[model samples]
Target: MTSNDAVLVLVVVTALGFDFTNGFHDTGNAMATSIVTGALPPRVAVAISAVLNLGGAFLSTAVAATIASGLVDSQDVTLTVVIAGLTGSILWNLTTWFFGIPSSSSHALIGGVVGATMAAAGSSAVKWQGLVSKVIVPAALSPFIAGSVAAIGTYLVYRLTRGVSEGPRGHGFRIGQVGSASMVSLAHGANDAQKTMGVITLALIANGTLESGAQAPTWVIVSCAVAIALGTYLGGWRVIRALGKGLMEIESPQGMASESASAAVILCSTNFGYSLSTTHVATGSILGAGVGKKGAVVRWHVARRMVAAWLLTLPAAALVGALAYWTAHGIGGTEGVVVIFVLLVLASVAFFAASRRAAVTPANVNAEWTGSVLPAPESKEATSWTPGST
Candidate 1:
């Protein structure tokens, strides 16, 4: 194969890898509340979300177009830039996942590409206005908008159902939570899956395999959808635990309100072709639910940490993206890309090994939050001294 073709192949593979991480990283956005509220089993919630995410990918190409052409100067993008960007995104995703933080995969991808582009070309290559208006403004505004909607929704839901019997009320809200959560999954697919498609499309444009203004090809759409769907099915249980249990204790009605708010905001943003972070919207909605309830407690400390991470995500990922670009550019050619790819693989393995030491699976995902992402250790005395044995 030609050298360009080989590089293009690598770019496509890396893009899909990013798509996979996007799926699992943000799965909690859709299903965490549902799982925590007993609206659906953990595995089942993710499974349902996976199917909806795949379906959502085909709903439109507007957001994909925005990603491909709106954020940066497509003329300046290169296969090398794309590769470095994906590396930055993947590493950031893994880092956040390991710490069980629900940072934005969307912002990471955008930051990586923008930073790599700046490193390769210059600040002039970026569409600064588009970045601010479409991305920055939306990011700043969306959380509050969603939070307000959720707060109102939560208040209304609780007030309206105040007279209902406790058992039936919980059961009814659980069912509503399932539907609202499903909409969120669909919205997430439409929003997040399109991001990888956009990156792949950008790569193709850079490689001259497609015209600069071209939309994402059908194959690109399908592949992104499937990769993300598969990743969603695997579930990011650590992130699930954090969003579901760490922020606040969510009742069924509040869960429904939060999911509804998230779904509405995401779907609306997708329609406008804005690639906003599902993580931000979902977290805000959850916080709103906590606030709206009469006696509910919002964990400000946990919320503060999340807000700090949100503030750091773009700049941190961009810094990594810039470094990746310099590293690859210094090494030169396909070899440089290969070297960075190898490093990414090694880093991923190391992180995975580290995570296994304090693994968060579905079984312990809903374990009582003990002020950390990892569950409290089972007592040795309890394990060794069973009542029957005693």
Candidate 2:
């Protein structure tokens, strides 16, 4: 392969890598409520989501098209810029997952690319109009829409089921949560997986391998689908713990309502070619469930932290993307890409090591919420016999 071909190959691989992180990082969006409410086992929940996500990838390409041509000028995007953007996105995803924050993977991907594009060329290269209409507007509105729907749904669920006994009501809702969560997993695949396809298509156009405005190639679609599916199967337990337990106490009825509302909003946005953040939608739906139920603990402190993360996600990822682009451009050529790539790998390893120190696993994912993602480890005194107290 020629040097340009080599760079293009590296870009595609890096984009797939980002897709992988997106998969695991956002698994909680679809499965967290179900797992927390015991509608499905943690492993079973993610496995079903993975399969549905793979199926969902084949459902539409509208979101993919939007990402390829809507956000920025394809002509201005280069291999270095694409790789740098992926680097920024991957790092951010890992960071948020480590802290168990359910941040938007969608914004991180877009912000990184936009930031890299601006750094490499200038603000003029970005299609500001498309960015505002397609991305920003949807981001602002989706959570409210989803939250409202979930709140209404939760309220109705209680009202309609008031005559029924608690046992049957809880059992029925748990069953319903399974189907609703599956729909969310499917919707997630249709929406989130497409972002990667668009990025890879963008890279292809930049390298002159494909003409501007061409749709994502068949191979691109299939590869992205597989990558995301694999990542989903791995499961982002840290994020799942936070969303399912940290945000609020989610019962079976609330979980069903939240999942159903999120799936509807996400699928609708996908149909309209809007790149809505599933994280925002899911988070809002969960919060709305709390609101609809009287006397339920909403944990506004946790909610506030999530809101802060949402506001910061775009700019923070952008800064990293711009810095990565500058570093790669400064080094000049394939060498720069390699250096940044190596650095990203090191950073990822560091995050992984740190996470292992207080790892969240399926075994303890459903543990009581204690105001943190990683449940505090069982103290030796609690687990073992100390002579002092019996």
Error of 1 at 184 (Å): 0.2
**Prediction RMSDs, each to the true structure:** 4.9, 4.7
Can you write out model 2's per-residue Cα lDDT over 217-252, one digit (the tens) per residue? 999999999999999999998788778877788888
Clashing pairs in 2: none
lDDT of each: 0.89, 0.89
**Total colliding residue pairs, candidate 2:** 0
Off-target runs (Cα >4 Å) in candidate 1 are 367-390
Q: Residue 20 lDDT in model 1? A: 93
lDDT score at residue 77, model 1, on the 0-100 scale: 93
Q: Write the per-residue lDDT of candidate 1 for residues 1-390, one digit (tens) a residue.
A: 999899999899999999999999999999999988888988899999999999999998888998899999999999989988888899999999888888999999999999999999999999999899878899999989999999999999989999999899999999999899999999999999999999999999999999998999999999999999999999998788778877888899999999999999999999999989999999999999998999999887888888888898888888899899999999999999888888988998998898777666776664442222433347321212111110
Clashes of each: 0, 0
